[model samples]
Target: AQSVTQLDSQVPVFEEAPVELRCNYSSSVSVYLFWYVQYPNQGLQLLLKYLSGSTLVKGINGFEAEFNKSQTSFHLRKPSVHISDTAEYFCAVSDQYGGATNKLIFGTGTLLAVQP
Candidate 1:
């Protein structure tokens, strides 16, 4: 089974400040990792994903993440954040060999609170 763990329940940061949301996963088989953000009254949006290839993957809104195999971490980082960045972030993992279902197991989620 694959599972994700988000270390922080909430992350507070000021405008234009850098932030990192920690995410770690535990899986017995190969898996695909992803970061999704949900804004107020909106659906979940894909921030980034790591299917294969390079370890460093960049996503929209100036966000990026590094896939660390040894540590089993795919932490999301932003050099600078804005007030609009405030939202609920989620870390999810899907079993690579799960076939067509491609069901995703998500973490508890991390709330990013940006203060002006």
Candidate 2:
């Protein structure tokens, strides 16, 4: 099975601030990358992914990530984040050959605190 690690368990910042959520993965075979965000009591939503194509990928809400195969990392970054961006973030990976039911393996979790 594959795995992911989120270096920081919590990230705090002021309103309209900048933040970066570090993510690293381990897999012997090819894999797909994904970032999901969870607001207060909401379910996780897909923020972005690095599939088979480009190394750089963009997602909703002013966030982006670059797939670095050599480093086995796909870190998320945002130049400026809003208070609304405060939420729990998770980094995940899925086997490229796994079927639709193949669940994703996620990092423990990261709580983003944005001060107003």
Candidate 3:
């Protein structure tokens, strides 16, 4: 089985400050990594993903993440943040070869609090 770990449950930063949310995973087979954001009372939106080529991946809303196979980590970063950026971020993973039923395993989630 595969699992994702979000080191921090919450990240608090003032408006315009940079932030990084850490995520790590453990899996025996190949896996695809993803970052999704959920605003209050809304569904999750795909932030970034690591499918195949290119170690670095960029996503919507000025978010980016680097896939490190050695460490099995895909940490999300934002150069600057806005109050609107405050939301719950979840790191998810799915087996690349585990067929269609391979559901995405998500992390506990990190709540990013951007105070104005």
Error of 1 at 65 (Å): 0.3
- Residue 25 of model 3, lDDT score: 100
Instruction: Sort the candidates on TM-score, descending order.
Output: 1, 3, 2
How do the residues 71-107 of candidate 1 rate in per-residue lDDT, one tens digit apiece?
Answer: 9999999999999999999999998999899799999
Worst lDDT run of 10 residues, candidate 2, spans: 95-104
Clashes of each: 0, 0, 0
Candidate that beats the other on TM-score, 1 or 2, i.e. the better one: 1
- Please, what are the lDDT tens digits per residue for candidate 3 over residues 8-114? 99999999999999999999998999999999999999999999999999999999999999999999999999999999999999989877695899999999999
- Over 1-116, each residue of candidate 2 has an lDDT whose tens digit, in order, gives 79999989999988877888999999998999999999998999999998889999999999999999999999999989898899999999998889878679999888989898
Q: Which stretches of candidate 1 lie over 4 Å from their true place?
A: none
**Which TM-score value belongs to model 2?**
0.95
Q: Which stretches of candidate 2 lie over 4 Å from their true place?
A: none
**RMSD each, Å:** 0.5, 1.0, 0.8
Q: After the best TM-score superposition of candidate 2, give how far the Cα of residue 73 lies from its true spot, in angstroms.
A: 0.4
